[model samples]
Target: MEISARNSIKGTVKKIVHGSVNTEIILEVASGVELVSIITKSSAENLGLVEGKQAYAVIKSSDVMLAVE
Candidate 1:
């Protein structure tokens, strides 16, 4: 909520793919524009990420992270 990173895109969770170690999440930022973020499986679950849920795609330097409230 109060951080330093400036590159943040609000979008809805579009898709999710689970792997053994990581999970792939796709966020639809715009009509056809989407951002994909790969995070740890436990992290994804901890965030309660699900399709149609609102989330933020935080981009800092070369890393893309996901955040929720």
Candidate 2:
């Protein structure tokens, strides 16, 4: 897929959490680092997203948010 996001990281899907409306895909990148992507169930199914499958996490700098506790 052609994503406009420049900060793209390739990783494997490590886990999938299906919610009532949306699904959360967890991807494991380098050592102990994980990236999360949220998508609709239909979209996830359409993309055939599954654990252990190769996928790309497209992240844009503008989309990132910072928080402190």
TM-score of each: 0.87, 0.82
Q: Model 1, residue 24: what's the lDDT? A: 100
In the range 21-68, model 1's lDDT, one tens digit per residue, is 999999999999999999999999999999999999988896658999
Model 1 weakest 10-residue run by lDDT: 56-65
Report model 1's TM-score to 2 decimal places.
0.87
Taken over the whole model, the C-alpha lDDT of each candidate is 0.96, 0.91
Clashing pairs in 1: none
Candidate 1 Cα deviation (angstroms), residue 20: 0.7
Query: Local error of candidate 1 at 26, Å?
Result: 0.3
- Mark the 10 consecutive residues where model 2 has the least summed lDDT: 57-66
CA shift of 27, model 2, Å: 0.4
For candidate 2, the TM-score is: 0.82
For candidate 2, lDDT tens digit of each residue in 1-69? 787777889999999999988999999997799998899999999999999999998877755578999
